[model samples]
Target chain A: MGNADSLLQAEGLSRDYEHYNAVQDYQLTLKRGEILGLLGPNGAGKSTTLRMLSGTLAPSRGAISIKGIDLLQQPRRAKQSLGYLPDQPPLYFDLTVEEYLGYCGRLRGIRKADVEPAIQRVIKTCSLEEVQKRLISHLSLGYQQRVGIAQAIIHEPDLVILDEPTKGLDPIQINAIRDLIRNLAEQHAVILSTHILSEVEAVCNRVQIINQGQIVHESQLGIQEPDKVFFQLHLARPPETAQIEALQGVESVIAQDKGRYLISVENAQAGLQIVTSAIIQNNWGLLGLCPQHESLEQTFMQKVFQEDRP
Target chain B: MIGLITRFEYRRLFLSPLAWTLIAGLQFILALLFLVFLENFITELQPRLALIDDAPGATDTVITPMLIWAGILWLAVIPLLTMRSFSEERLYQRQALLMSSPISISEIVMGKYLGLLLFLATALSPTLLTAVSLSTGTQLDWGKLIAGFMGLYLMLASFSAAGLFLSTLSRQPAMAAALSYGLLALLFVFYITGKTQGSESVLFIYLSHFGHFLNLSSGLVYSSDILYFLLFSTGFIILTIQRLDSDRRNG
Candidate 1:
């Protein structure tokens, strides 16, 4: 099913290599201003899926519609709204940054008059102003990556797909690129694949973990409902699990080692108030209390490695 | 889109030292050959030609042979020029930029083809100037010179088209160049075999590029020869487009 306002939609996408299938029945629907992080291990078809979505690689058996235009039937029109950066940055090393971006702008069908402004805008956005006139081969890896991103967005496409935008970079460069991606999400729907788990947690509002050429897990990030809250509690005076479970909004309590307890509750705010008061009244000294959600790293590990245990 | 790609490719061609080196080297070789041809015409053929009526002029004695030599030189040079057209892009993974840019395969192929053709035309300019210089000292056959240049250009176009197709088939530029040289040399072999075999193998001669090129370079603009070049270039260009389309489809 396609959404009218969606920027990208694909159904039943599959890619078959010579001896085996690389991707199978991949599906995605991205609305405007949404960033979808695709996370997968090595050889998990993330690149293949992104390549198909960006109209660079054709799918064997599926339909993809970009801004409601069928990619297979009307690829040129559909691709006008799409931009992609593959795993390796597709750069002509001989051209300068400004020249390359200008070419990309023209290639993306920006008018001659608008190409300069588009180049300027992306140059400023990607913080490439100082090195704009330098040859791309002379730039460092970080700047090269920024230039790659600049070209992808120079045309102001509705959808931008990037494969491993920050695979090899220092922490500072990674943060800078993350900030750029976040800024891009303000206007364009972004789909990026990364090996870093925290990258998804930091930048993406939604994430999908793919393994074995199929999406194994998908969830919204940092948007948990109040009812599904878990709190880790440490008390100086030990208490039985039954006593904590008796608190009014508390769903269950599991005791951990060293006076620590993991408690699930119906509502986070009400449960915190009830549990704190109960602990004070019972004279069980509260050592530490904090809301603890399941980290994405654990989920990724389980979803990726669990399936491998045949 | 094609114009944008063509312009960018043309500009990029000039940015690399390889193009400049090839152009300079070709000019040096051709200029030396022009002198040798000029010296031979003056010292050995001038008196013999004076005794005969309707004798071969400078255009026939000097320009035609030089043009033929230029054509043969380009058979090797065009492959080096066209080898990087698609092969380098595919090797560096830069082809995705174009493939995803809302441009069709034909536009990409034609854009690259025209860009290389433009550069080859530029490389051919020195030879034309050398031939035109003869007009200052003697009567020059302008028709034959133009016909010879046209034939050489068409032959280069066919060589580049085939080279572009071979570039699409390989990721390494060296491999593409070798394949192109092999294919062009095979055509030359066909020409030699057809000439030696005489009337028995008309098809081979017709199929060979040299036969049509020779017809055009001899001040003969046969419609069949022009059509053969047109069909040969268009056929290879179409094959390049189909190969790229299949690469995208099956990738």
Candidate 2:
């Protein structure tokens, strides 16, 4: 996964359904060894964006490439390198688990001889060994989703796109699928679109949030760089005292209580050094100095709400 | 690959017990009607039959095969067989998996068409025994029997393509089925209207399904009739592929 990068890229892709702009100028890029999550509320054009990237739907404007193959111009070649799991799993309910996956493998252009081994690998990966022969319609939604995922990757496609893979699953099933997505990222570039922010937090390496047909926010895992700094200080009462106020990078300090203060600082680490060192040297009790960073969930909500229209 | 797809489709659609039952049921009903009509012909015209003993009637040559139990069954049951081809897929939303796969649209359409072709051939098989029985026992016109089957197969296959085209347009199987029947009924009316008026009705000629059916069923194979059904099948299939493309783009 680390050896190769940027398996799928969609640049300025847009779609218009009749008079409505379902997705407009949606630029999304997916790199190998990364699980990019497409996050948006319902009717925010998530499905449209996914369909266009997968070439299951064409964009009215812009182009997409799978491994540098032009999707709109050479769809068959581009689609050969891709796999898409639609919101509806597209399971042929009448076919058994193995039969459906085998058919999908063949459809995805896997050689006839390699199909059996491919099916076996997907079955094991998706934990469908027990239900391999069972009819898909009889399976629970969780198993059905697993089957859906199994079919999507049976051909060992370089880029796998899943739309709401865990929508109807229970928590246990959701956890299992999250683990499955993480496992898939070990080999393939996985792009999943969901409204579940926690899903992005759990499995994805990066996330691109689409709101009303455009990208509103993009973030990485681990919240490495927060857009805003939050400060939590524990100290002995230090007012606008020289030890605190005379810090070189001090912006402002609001003393919450005798022992606690909410300090606004220009640089978080700089603020931490001065405030903690000053409290210690001045013989004021140095309890704690914590700079709060935004969680992905908070960042997601703020970006979405900030751009939200009345 | 096409052969494998055709075989898989054959099993999926043609091997069903319900499919066999539909074919056998239609076969028996048509053969029974033929038996009744033949018995009446044998009973009422016994004396006249002696006069034309060495001469075959034009009605036997033209109308018997043209309007036979086999011919009507071929045309009538086609809608049921083909209405679910694409409509069922659309309703189930399984078409994404089918169309999104690396297979070309031509292969998919042709594979399913061949599968339906096999099913239609199966439906026409039981009546072949009836043909053999009459040919051996009553000295029936073997040429006409063969021609009728060939014509009916080609004619009905063209109609089935139209049914499949309508199926691709709508998700509701019932609506697809009704719309197919509605178009078939209109074609029949055009032929009837042409018969009502003495001269050729150009609109009726253009629309008449029987016009194509008659040209071949009478043991006379005209290239025009062959071209008409061939063009009809190819045109509808192309339309079906385009509709699928439109759907994927909009979806």
Candidate 3:
């Protein structure tokens, strides 16, 4: 079931192979104007989930609703609201960029009268103006990617799903695409899947890390305040672990060898003040204190690799 | 939506040089055959033209044979033309685009079928026009010409449908073409068996398309013959749609 405010909602989504699950019990909800990034390694079910969302693949069990329309029951109507760019851009090399985009617009059920204007809008938005007349096969890789995006958004769908939108591109083109995605999210609920973490930090507001066909971690990107903060401190004479744990903002304190203490603080700024004051009052000489953050890269690696540990 | 797909397919086929080249080559070959047959008729059958009350004229002696030759040509060419319908999409991984679109599988199959039919009709037009032009110089039977054309059109439609169906089964266009040829050859082989003992095996003669196609070409329009063509084309088209639906479900 979709919430009134949700632009897209999926529940209990699962796709199964003969003996393995490709994706299992996946849930997602995206509000209008929100960009959700799906991050995962190869064969981690990001593409499979996106394919199901785009109505191209049937899930073994799931319910997907786009703008209050059920995907399985009314696929055509539901798909009318979706725009998808597969991991490999599905392009017709023989057609010109303009012609290809026009076909895409009509393929999405855009009105005949509206297809021309829609093509023009996507072409301009994707920066495909200069090569609109050129055959897709003749264009450079960057331009082909642009044309791929143009085709996806030509129908002005409410939900845009992109898989590896910037898989292979120079830094300059990547930046341009990042900006274009930001603009697209202003009007549509966008779900972007990529292996690149920087892309999520640069364009996505929220990120989900998928591992072994399941979402293992999800968090907001570029938030001002961290959810949990860690600190590594060395002391000449360390206090007891309970003494540190008793501090106002301290969540946990673990003793390390060689007179080191590891503290988890719920609020780093306030905890820094309390811990420091307590250390000074107790006369336990604070050798060094460094605040540590769990970056997205670390979180991703931990979640993906932690399962491998016995 | 189906109309849009059909129109889009037609434009794509027209823009491709392969379709044009095939049409031009067929026209050239038919023209040469036309002249050679017309010369043969003038020399051998001119004196006997008025001997019987009803005798074979230009439409029979020349046009019908020419159409049969064109029919044989289509056996090879239609497979090439229709091989790319879905096979190329699979080869380039562009099936995602069409499969992801909101259109139903039936619409996609019908669109490709109609598009290829239009292209085949355009390619066969020049040869038909040449046969029509024979009336200006000598007596011609419009009924026989039309029946022959209807037979040719039906055969092309069936061949193209089978080829399109084969295309959905493989990603390699050449392999699709080969499979389509194999199917047509199977049909022809069955027809050849029936020919060995004319009318002895009613089942074999009726099962093969050759007897029915020849029946129609000789100005015999049986409802059964038309039904055979319709069922042949529709059966393959339905199979193609079902194949796509299964791929979506399974993949």
The numbered model that scores best in lDDT is 1
RMSD in Å for all candidates? 1.6, 3.9, 3.4
Highest TM-score scorer: 1
Q: Which runs in model 3 stand beyond 4 Å of their true positions?
A: A231-291, B198-200
**TM-score (second chain) of model 1:** 0.97
Q: Where does candidate 2 stray beyond 4 Å?
A: A1-4, A223-254, A262-291, B15-17, B37-50, B57-67, B138-140, B198-202
User: Per-candidate TM vs. native?
Assistant: 0.97, 0.88, 0.91
Candidate 1 lDDT over A64-111, as tens digits, reads 999889998998998899888998889999999999999988888799
Higher-scoring candidate on TM-score, 1 or 3: 1
Alpha-carbon shift of residue A56 in model 3 (angstroms): 0.6
lDDT of 1 at B113: 88
Candidate 3, B152-181: lDDT as tens digits: 899888878889999999999999999988
Clash pairs, candidate 3, are none
- Measured by DockQ, the strongest candidate is 1
Tens digits of per-residue lDDT for model 1, B67-170: 99998887877888888989999998888999889888899888988888888888889889999999998999898889999999999988889999999999
Candidate 1 local lDDT, residue B56: 96
What TM-score does candidate 3 reach? Answer: 0.91
Q: What is every candidate's C-alpha DockQ against the true complex, given to 2 decimals?
A: 0.85, 0.51, 0.66
- A best-first ranking of the candidates according to their lDDT comes to 1, 3, 2
Better of 2 and 3 by lDDT: 3
Q: For each candidate, give the TM-score of chain B.
A: 0.97, 0.89, 0.96
